[model samples]
Target: MELPTALYLPGDDGGFTATPLTIGPWDVTLQHAGPPAALLLREAERVSGIEGGQTVRLAYDICGPVPVGPVRVRGSVVRPGRRVELVETVLEVGERPLMRLSAWRMRTRADDPAAAVARDAEPHPAPLEPAGSRPEVPAFFTTDVAYHRALEWRFAEGSFNAPGPATAWTRTRSELVAGEPMTPLQHLLVMTDAASGISAALDWNTATFANVDLGVALHRPPRGEWLGMAARTVLGGTGAAQCFAVLFDEAGPIGRSSQSLFVEPRAQA
Candidate 1:
């Protein structure tokens, strides 16, 4: 069988076909949450019909492990508003449902310094050097997965292979889709799924964590290609955990992202 060249390719029936880029950490034969999530938002934006609105929130629920290969993506507008719109996208492989994504798109108001009275803004550290590369953390064997190779990453603080909180700058070199240009929101969404790996509270060799859901809220749309995430993972004694991150671009803080994880010890070999 041929390996996937891109994340997806258009299908004859209006749905797009899935590729190996969908592969996730849990299984090589399965798909990652990042690609599908971004793809869902892409479809949702198309269906929203809002001329010029920013996606304020993007959330996803992982129904189960998404298998690799051809999957169908369907999107529709669930709520309509002049200022805001709600859209949903579902990914299914054959007859099995994999995941569902919901997004909130809001219209942008003209920027007027006089009218912008005390706008809430998040504080961010000085932006990392975009042109420099840091050493890769060896502990992140998860990075060995096929999907992880699709993007370029530079860590300024914590390494995905190392424990504790981390600050990472990431970007994609290849198109998520063959011909379609990826949006700023899509670029930001791609890195949101990396939150858990960026800052591991537990050892990857002994513990396994899978995020069951992902939620992202953006104060504003990202401007440049470089997306920086300052992330931390928290694991509880009760086998529950959360990963949180503050997102930024070269300009400044754009928003935040979170993940609810299913934490457990990996079965001994």
Candidate 2:
């Protein structure tokens, strides 16, 4: 099986193009919020020019359905500074803008020894067991390069098809761009937008939960390739919901992510 994560095509004009591997929730023809979000983050980090700093927060707005194939990407520094830098990246198909993303990069600081000793913390969850085979999922939800094939998912608390909160360990076995190196932040961000799928509170056969926006905040730079997510979806009566994922790596708690979801019945294509 081929990897599903690498979706950026090298462009002749020194830019990158979108590929079908970016496909997401709505359908196969559209790209997922995670891949584009990761792509934007990659560019943001590049343009920010703040080396040794970490991404403190990332906010992405899905302006419309991000179509598959050959979308253009542009990254720029909106507010530049030494301690804090704001960067933005936009993905467009022709003249139509599909998604816009902004990120805040902050400088790293030496930790206070006293602060480290003052707080008590829980131990990391037990390592997940080997996931022998990919679980069976509905055909409508499956893509040409399935998520299971791209990422090594060792589920500890919940399942993809089940309707409830979930906790799982995810490690990237695939690349974000074909030949480009994916940073730790990019790796984490690639799965941030999948909180809805990791923990679906709604039925897949009858309902839809489309996240229009994603907000991610990291307390410290993540280490190791494996990332863990404890995600849940909370729905309200006003046709809105939220998917929150507490992120982790082998070391300890790293950060958290939030997605503003537009919950509704699945619309026929």
Candidate 2, number of clashes: 0
Which residue segments of model 1 deviate by more than 4 Å?
A: 1-5, 114-122, 132-145
- Candidate 1: pairs in clash: 22-31, 22-32, 140-161
Best by TM-score: 1
List TM-scores for all candidates, in order. 0.90, 0.89
| 54-81: candidate 2 lDDT, tens digit per residue | 8888889999987777777788989989
Please identify model 2 stretches exceeding 4 Å from their true place: 3-5, 111-120, 125-140
- Per-residue lDDT of model 1, residues 1-269, tens digit only: 23445677887777676666666776677777888888888878878868788899988999988776677888888998988989998988887778899999988888766533433353454245667647353444443545665567888887777689988887775567768777778877777898888788988778889899999998778887778888988877798999999988876777889999998988877
lDDT against the true structure, each candidate: 0.78, 0.76
